[model samples]
Each structure stands twice: as structure tokens, then as C-alpha cells.
Target chain A: MNKKCTTDPDRSYKQPEFDLDKYIPGHSVDCVIVGYENQQLKILLVKWKLGGPWALPGGFVGRDQDLEAAAHQVLEERTGLKSIFLQQFHTFGRSDRHSRFKEQMDQVKAISQQLGTMDLKFSKWASQRFISTGYFALTEIKKTCPKPDFLSEKCEWVSLEKLPELIFDHNKIVDKTLKHLRIQLNFLPIGISLMPHKFTMQDLQKLYEAILQRPLERSNFQRKILKLGMLHRNGKLLTGAANKAPYLYSFNLEKYNSMVENGIGFSYLGDKIL
Target chain B: MNKKCTTDPDRSYKQPEFDLDKYIPGHSVDCVIVGYENQQLKILLVKWKLGGPWALPGGFVGRDQDLEAAAHQVLEERTGLKSIFLQQFHTFGRSDRHSRFKEQMDQVKAISQQLGTMDLKFSKWASQRFISTGYFALTEIKKTCPKPDFLSEKCEWVSLEKLPELIFDHNKIVDKTLKHLRIQLNFLPIGISLMPHKFTMQDLQKLYEAILQRPLERSNFQRKILKLGMLHRNGKLLTGAANKAPYLYSFNLEKYNSMVENGIGFSYLGDKIL
Candidate 1:
């Protein structure tokens, strides 16, 4: 807040390269960059550069580019993260969904103040009836840097429990994404992808507990997960506990990815005390 | 084709009630009406009035309507069906997805001939970059009284096997919906919603076989399905076979719905023969 940040809101205006021919006007792509750390689920949000509420980092799709590719581009541009697990869950299309976020208009006003120009065409372009597609990505939080786009002031990862007041129905989108993630957890072996290399059985259990919001019996959880054949036992972790240390494990990426793509048959057993 | 039906492509032109304000400019809703009967899956499609390729029944959404409601309205307007099971699966948003359907433009060209007027404004409105949300519904084929809209020549229920080349990417949309449906079959007890009121185990197994696209061992499938506790044993059907009569079952709607909302743990048990 003291020094001028490298990024500014007027980057697009600074470079008058686009004339609507290079962009898809009435559609946008938003990424829900979800990361897990310290047993807490967090999402990355960008504060609009000009004094507005936080918004899911999003951008317009290019005229010739695929919607999915545009989401990846936005993800990379906003967070500097690449090649992570991304899924397109839903598209928000209520007519008034975008219009409900009046606070975001302050961003336009601030841009006008900064640039010393009140461009009506820019305002109209911003206020168009835009239908947005939401893509969610799961990445290791500590592995990459998150940089805000030229239109945002800062990039922050906020915990799901204390999420700020998001613009529009982003909160709803996040909720839907969480539900989808939890559902996928039942069928997809995401532990390895969401975890670091060589973690203990307790660490894996903690991840499952965080997502499922329920406790699992140590023996049963280990048996059920190990039965899937997606994990490889690697030595042991000294947890300083009274009992024997749990075995260290790493997921077989090939097996984990195949299960993610074609789903593993592990959801049938209820959260029973097996 | 024989009667020169009262409905035609120029119907909208005949009524000048609609202005530019009536529709949400660049978003639409499409419905994949699926029905199961005779141990096969089928989908309902509409043909363009001016002799163009067939398409899923779809319509531009109103300026202030929810996208899901628009899908249901489109389904009823085209199929005379209401209050059926509908799910929003995905949204299609490729830049060239809408523009590549040049053959469908013949309908607009035909409208110009029938009305004796060239409506350039209509053509411009039709060529906008529209993004569409896809919704799917399952209903009984025999009970449906499918009726085409003013812009469609006829309504037909096409089997998935002999599906005709559809307009735009509707075929792809249907294929995607089927994949989602199959994945969901692993989680949802849709047998009751997709079947007649009271059906025997053989009938239910046939439906499962149709969806799973493989044979299920008679005893094991029955045991697995019954274990879900979402089904109620009604009576027995005398198959007149050399064995015992197959029992009839109807889904307990409340249990079935709860399972649908929170997926039934049925996906893990693989399609293993008894």
C-alpha cells in the first residue's frame, strides 16, 4: 500500500490493442483457484484495482480461442500457476447476476480518475450482458507465486470459512465448486494430487477429514485407501507419537490421473466404521 | 410434409410483438429430452421448419428469467411434457461453435421468401455470439405428446443408435450428457424416476444393462440395488419361466431423492458378475 505496485488497472487501456475483434464481448471466464494448506481449504481472489470488492480472477475469452484455454490463460496470468488439475463445473447465467454487484463500479470510477478519462465505450463494454463460465483449479499453494492481473490491486488466498463478501454470485459459485469437489473426493483419488510428495498416513487422513468434514477410523481409512492401489508405501514418518510411526506414502501419478479421468470405484462404501 | 402444417418458419415474423428488448441477447438454453422404453435410450429433437438439419429444442432466454426455467419452458413447448427430472450438465462456449452452422441459415433465407421482406435486423440478431447452457430431462416416451414450436417443422424421438446429423454441436452435447448420465448412474437411484411405476427385477436389470451397456449377473445386481434401501418391494411378477417369480419394486421417493441430492454410495461396487 506504500509504494506503487507494478500492476495497474489500465493495462488494457494503456495498450489499445483490442477492438472487440480480438475478444468475445458478452462472455467471461472465472477461475476458482483452490489450495489446501494447514488442513484448511483456501481460494485465491483478486481485489479490483480501483477500490472495489474482491472478485474471482476472470477474463474474457478470445474470439478464436477455446473457452477452456481462456480459463487456463486467466489462471496463469492471475496466479502464475500452470498445468494444475482444472475442471469446468458450471456456468452462471442469471440475467441479473452481474448487475447485482454495484460496488464493482467503483473500479471503473477509480480507473477513470487514474487515467483522467471517463470513457463511455469502456463503461458500456464493462456493463454488457456477460455470461461467465467458471473453471476451478487445485494447485499446491506453496509451489507457485500468485500475482494479480493489471486490473487488480492484490492477490490474496482467503480461507473458505472466512471468505470476504464476493462480488455477484461468486459465493454461490464457490459453494457449488466445493460440493463438486467433495463429490469427486468420493470417486477420485485426489489425495496424491492435493498433497506433497512422501506424506504420512495421518497427513492423508487429515486431508480427507478436511474435505469430507468427518472423522475416519484409522484402520478402516488405511484399509480402504490402500485397497485402491493408487498409493505406494515409502519408509516411515517419525511423528513422536507413543505408537509406531505411520508409514510414509506417495501416490502413483499415473494411477491417480487415470482414476481422476475415469473415476475409481470407491464411493459405494458409506462412511462406515469398516 | 403432406398437410403443409399451420406452423412454419415465418411464424415469428407474422407476429411483430417482440422487440429487441424481449430476449437476453447472447445466451440461450437447450434441452436434451431423453426417454427410455423398449429397453433402449432415445432422445427427442426438433427439425427446422425450412428443411434444415435437426436440433435439440432450444430458445433464447428472457431478459430476466433463470436459465433453468428457460430450459423447462423449451422442453414443454416442444414436447408437451412438464414436471419431469431435469439436470443442468454443462454450458457450450466455443467461439466458432455457433458460427459454423451455415446450413441452418437457410431457414432465415426461407423466412425472407415467405414474408416477402428482407429483415436484415433479424439476420444480425440471429448471428450474435450466443453461449448456451445444456439441460437434460428423462421421461417416458409413450406418454409424451411432443409438439414442435412455430419455428420447427416436426418433432421426433430419435433412438441414440440411429441419431441423425444434428445442427450445430447438438450431437456432441447429447453425447456429453449421456456420459454424465452414466457417471451419475453410479451415484443416483434413477431407476424409479426413469421407469414405469411398478417394475420387476428383470425390467430394472434390463434398464441397468442398457445404461451400463453390459450384462449384470441376476443375483448380484438385485442384492446390490436392494442394499441401497431406496427401493420398496411391492409384489412378484410371474414371468412364467422355469424359476421363481421376479419381485416388483418401486423407489421410496424420499429416500431416492436424498440419495440423489447426496449421492448414494453405489459407484464403488464394480460391475462384477455373480
Candidate 2:
């Protein structure tokens, strides 16, 4: 993954000696980088340059680093977004998760032919079965300037509704991340981090609805959210809507945090919605 | 850990050479087996025979087994409980988590001396830093007869309030598991698994209070739980007191599952509880 020192490499790669002690072998970190933009929920993904399908922007944990720190580094490298809300929701350790790589051996061969060389050590090590820890990040899509790492073609925001074929268990990771987000939404007002500085009740509602994947009763959502004392009725938004101008509110940080700590409870959708 | 074949092994253990391909290196599974009895929350712990302090009843994941399967295997081996509600909550990946191994080297040495001959391979491999996935299981205490694994002393449920000195990050794992449980309570009618097959509203309320670690208004708690529609009120349980008997409720599986599927939301305790 790329941070500020974004570089592109399309040449023969030299393999390094295998040092099992230097890396937390058989484990990797995958970021389900969820973003909000244009009233749609999206995930930041990377197109591997070598021999793989598109996958979540992921990186190996440094031998010396804490997993959380590694996750932050990966997020920063992949999305150029840091200090956002990130949570380790699940760790996937299925034995057959790497079967996709075997199926994509053709792609591996094609990439090898195109690049004219493959890093032998990397090829051997990367093909091994790996258990991945999944961390989901919520950031405003506009703030992120995603750049691909040396091994990836490009990094871009893909709408969750229209995700391309992903490598390994990445598609499953994205699905789990969404489920975690929805469950978290039941107890926490989760979208303020992705919201603008000031927004109408409708804007907040839209963000929640997007994560929830369903429409919520507008006034009910507003009342429930307001009762948690998370929003400050700052002023009214001057909008193009013909109806009465909806009030603009900024998050009361203190109240929002306490509410998050105490869990603001609300239920949405049902089997009917399903 | 043993399922039913609980044989006491207070002896040194010879560790086998860890084959990298046969197992996912540097990763392990730890089960925070939480059980309830007499209105107290407890965790199943084991004492290592050759080294280490008291720790969670956990085992290694087979090379071919899924992480969840490994957790269940560990749980069943330790607690003799199978097909229970087990959730993988988090993974602990701090580099310094194994500081305890180095710090407790004296204890390891003492155990080695006591065991007459330390299995060099096992000792060296056991003390190495490991990232562990934490899975929490809730089952009725009466049904479980926890047995220690071959590598440790007897297994027993220790009250959450009076935890013994634990090896590595096991204590932190337990605390995190409880936090997960408490958070889960806001969204689901948990502790039902920890309760008797049939329980009064007061029994359920007490269980919640124990988990919540505070008092809740009785009527409010009853009203809230009843509203979830998961409880099927059976005949009332007559008591010696003159007050009206509390209704005994059985979990309506379909309704309870649906309520669990769509989170059951209610928040008790104030800002301080957080």
C-alpha cells in the first residue's frame, strides 16, 4: 500500500531471503475502508498489479508493531486517511480461503509473463494459507486521496452495491464489515465522523440509512437521534427543497461521546424490509 | 483440554517442532468461557503444568480447521460444552503481550525443575510471542463440567470479581469479552443462555444486573424486556411472600431469534456506568 511516497513499479523484482521472525507469518491485515459520498456507501479497494483479483487494501503486520498500529499504518498507506474510526471486527482463519489464489494461477502466470520476473520468495510466501484480521474504517470519501502501492494497479472507491470480483475472502470481509457497522448503528450514532461540519437532519438520516441499507422514518430518526442529545440545533439549512427548510445541526461532541458510551438504542427495518 | 477424557497430568510436556505449513504460525485461539451460577459471572481458567500462570481455557487451531471451529473445539475440550453460543469478539496482537513469558521465566524455570526435565522444544516454542483470537462462550454453569487440558492443572470457574494472576494478556481478554457481552446485551437478550431453561422476570433481571454491575429499576427493566417479545410467559411461580408471583418465561425460539437478529435495544445505567 502507498502512503505519501506513492510510487509505481513495473519491473523485475528481486526476491529477499525468507525470515520468518521478521513478519507475523500466516497473518495479515485487511482494511474494509468504508466511505460515504453522494449518498452512497462505498469501499476503497486495490487492484493488484501482479497475479490477483481486486482485494481490500491490506498489508502484513510488522513483527515489532502492535496490530492496531499496523492497521493504522495500512489505512494511512492505502487511503491516506488517518485517525479515523477503525475497529477490528473479525479475524478470518478458514483453511480454504486461499483457494482463490490457486484458481487465479492463470492470472499469476500472465502477470509473470508481463512483468518478465516474479519475486521467488514473495511468490512462495504469499501463496501460503494466511489468516487475516479485518478492520473496517469509516471516513469521508472526499477527504481520502487513495494511491496504489507498488504491487497494485490503482486504488479507488467502489460502491458497495457494485463491487467487482475480489480476491480470497475479501468479498466476505466486506459483507461482515457492513453487518458489524449495522449492529454498531443500533447502539451508537455512527455516521457523525462521515458527516459534514454542519448538516440537516436529513443529511444525518441519509448517512444512517446508507449504512443501514434501508430507509428510516425521517422524523422518527431525527427524534431518536436528538433525544440522545448528540445534535445541536445550530440553524436552518437554506436548501432547494419546496418544503419548510430543515434545521441544520452540529454534533455536540461531549454529548455525542457520552451517548456513544451509553449506546443510543434504535432498531430499523425488519423481515418485511429484508 | 479434554471433552470427557479428563485425566490429571501434573507433569512436564514435551513440545513438538512447530511445522509452519501444518499450522498458522504465531497465531492461537483463546476461549473466554463465561458461565453464570448463583448470580455471579465467572470465567473458566487453567493452570499450566510446566510453566506460565493461570490462563484462559484455550487450545491451538488445527492447520485445516476454521478459526470458529477451533474455538468450539477448545471450548468443548475445556468445558465439555458443544454447540453453544460462541462469538469471536476480538484478536489480541500486541508485541509485548508475551512480556509475561519473559517476566515469568523464573516460574517457568521453577516448573521445569519440578517436572525433573523440561521439554526443551516445548519450553522454547511455548514462550514465543503469539497473537490470539478471543472467542467468548456463554452456557449454563450447571450443565458444564470444565476439565483442564493435558498441559495444565485442573480447570475451574473463577468469579470475575476475584480473578487470579493470569499469564500474558488473558485477563485483558476476559475484560474485553465482558465488554463485548455488555454491549451485546444492549442489542440482544443475552444471559438467556446463562439462565435456567425457565426463569422468572426477576431471575433474568438479576442476571442482567450482575452483567451490568448495577441496579436497575425493576418495573422499567421488566417492561423493557417484556416489550422485546422474546419471552413466552409460562405459569407464574408462587412464592412464600404475599406479593403477586412473577411469571416464569421460556424463550420463544423463533421470536427470540428474530429479536436477536434485529437488535433488542435498551440502555440501563447512566453516564457513570460507561
**Over 4 Å off in model 2, which ranges?**
A1-21, A100-102, A105-118, A219-274, B1-22, B50-52, B105-118, B217-249, B261-263, B266-274
Chain A, candidate 1, TM-score of: 0.86
Each model's total of backbone clashes: 1, 1
lDDT of each: 0.75, 0.75
Q: Write the per-residue lDDT of candidate 1 for residues A12-33, one digit (tens) a residue.
A: 3233453555776777888998
Return the clash pairs for model 2, or none.
B1-B149
Residue B74 lDDT in model 1? 81
Model 2 lDDT tens row, B61-160: 6778888898888887776667998888999999888764666765754564444233554455555567899999998878777766656766888888
In model 1, the Cα lDDT at residue B102 comes to: 68
Off by over 4 Å in 1: A1-21, A100-118, A232-248, A272-274, B1-21, B99-118, B226-251, B272-274
Q: Enumerate the candidates' DockQ scores in order.
A: 0.42, 0.44
Q: How many backbone clashes does candidate 2 have?
A: 1
State the lDDT of candidate 2 residue by residue for A1-274, as single tens digits: 2234332232211223324446777788999988888899999988878545798988777787888888897788776666988889999988888765666755654553454234555555666678899998888777777877555777899988899989877888988888888866765667777888788888888898888777889778778788777778987876787888888889889988877776655545232222
